[model samples]
Structure formats: structure tokens, C-alpha cells
Target: MDLAQRIQKMITPTIKDQGYEIVRVQITGAKHPRLQIMAERADGTCIDVEDCATISRSISAVLDVEDPIEGEFTLEVSSPGIDRPLTRLQDYQTWAGFDVKIELKTGIDGRKRYLGRLLGLDEEQRILIECEEDEPHTLAFEDVQRAKLMLTDELIAAAATEQTK
Candidate 1:
């Protein structure tokens, strides 16, 4: 229903047809909005510049016909990168055991942010994070406003291992 969701819906098929999965779609700025589309290879390989260009072209074609935006906007296509935003529930599972920073839509016990090791999702699909405290914290997935992997040596090594595979 929102701009990003609309854009994602419009371009998802095209992107999937090209063997890519969209990671996230975001529209920012007021004067000249920027449409940022983060995507990854469906095969789990690293995305390259050529991949970005191909996705950009495909998305541009769809947007050109749909004319979704009221005014001029910039379309950017890129990979999720090493420190990627966890936009989907699957992302949490995929990146489990890594350090992450999660921000909630509303504070819990006067705390709005959490930094800890991701323990993946629980049976109810709620997020499980092991903070510095004694017990792990359980958060509702829907309550998470934004979350991203923390850049660390372990993450970098994991990314390298994945790329080499």
C-alpha cells in the first residue's frame, strides 16, 4: 500500500524472472525522491555491477510504463552488501548467529533498540536475541521497524566463505 510496497509489487515478477530476489525497496527524500532497490541473486551468489545494471534496466522499464511516481525520481539498484538490512523474516534465519542491531517501532520497557547476537525466530515467528543480559530477549517480528547485520570480523569471514562457495 505504501510507495515502497507498491514499487516492490510492481517489479517483483520482473526481478524474479531475471533470477534475482529483492531484498528491500525504499523511497526517501521529499524534493527528489530516491527509489533504492536492494536485491540478491536467487542462486545465493554475490551480485555484481552488471547485475545491478540489469535490474535497474528491468525496473526502469516497468516504472516507465506504470508511471507510479508523481514526479521525477531516481531509481537505484544494488546488492544488499556485507552489512545488509534484514527486511524479511527469512533474513533473520539466514543470518542467524551474527551480531545485529534491531530497532523497534515502539519501545519495550523503555528500550527501543537492541544490539546482540541473533538467535533467529522462535516457534511463533518472533525474533530471539541474546543480549548482554542473562536471558535472551524475545521480540515480536511485527514490532521490528528496522534491523541490520553488524559489521564485524566474523561477519566478514562468513561473507567471504559464502562468496567462495
Candidate 2:
């Protein structure tokens, strides 16, 4: 498994016990590697600074013991904000009807990126996106390199509604 995957496996139990679920784990940079852990409250509430601090401390303790990284690395814990990434398959269903930007690992129809309304996943588990084309484009889940919600008034309003819940 990759470094980020390994780290996620190591930290998931602790994070879940703390009532949070990881959105994504990414390790970037060479000289000064930065480990970014995006998480959200399992209760469907917004996570705050205190939650990030708590997660950071807990993850720090776990990493110190495991020593997963060869050298010193910066660990960052934060919530996936309003325009969050669609990392898991459930995210697509949850955020259906929102505008999104999806990039594929390889070009499809002479394009690598697509911007349109998210139609969620089809029966075959492929991502469905309605672009400028007449019909919705069906994209394989494995082809997606990265996908995230587009920042729009509708999304902002939805986020506000979620926060108040």
C-alpha cells in the first residue's frame, strides 16, 4: 500500500473512536513532506478547530509510535470545507445535484476534465455527469483522478442548511 493509505489504515481506528471519519489523506512534497488529513464529524455536524486539534494530537501520538515516515514530516488535520472533495463513492450519492469538476487519469472523448452537474453513480457504479452534451456522460469510477464540488450559491446554501441541522 502507498504511504497515505498506510497512514490512513493506522489512524482510522483512532479517528473513528473520536467520532470523526476521514475524507482524504494526502502526502505531498519531497524535502518537506506535508501530510494532510481531511476529516468530518460522524454525527453530520461541522468540525471545528477544537476537533482538528484533538485529531492532530491523537494522530501525532499514534504516528510517533509507528514511525511510518522515514524523516520529519508536517502533519495537518482539517475539515473538508464547503466545496469538499468527493473521495468516497458515497460522496457522489450524497452530493448529487451539485455542480462538480471531475478529472480523469486518462482523457475521455479528447478531454481529461469535465465540469457539469453531478448525476451520481449509475447501476454499474460508474460516475454520471451531465455536461454540455445532449446525453449524460458515464465515466468509470476507476478512471477518476480527482473530483470535487464546485463552489456555488446552491452549494453554499446547502452547507448553511447542513450546519444549522
Clashes of each: 0, 0
What lDDT would each prediction earn against the true structure? 0.93, 0.93
lDDT of 1 by residue, 1-165 (tens): 898899899999999999999999999999999999999999756699999999999999999999998899999899999999999998888889999999999999999999999999999888999998658999988899999999999999999999888
| Candidate 2, residue 71: lDDT | 95
Q: Residue 145 in candidate 1 has what lDDT?
A: 95
lDDT by residue (100-156, candidate 2, tens digit) is 999999998798999999999899888899997667898887888999999999999
lDDT of 2 at 153: 100
- Please give the lDDT score at residue 2 for candidate 2: 96
Q: What is the lDDT of residue 105 in candidate 2?
A: 97
Residue pairs clashing in model 1 are: none
Off by over 4 Å in 2: none
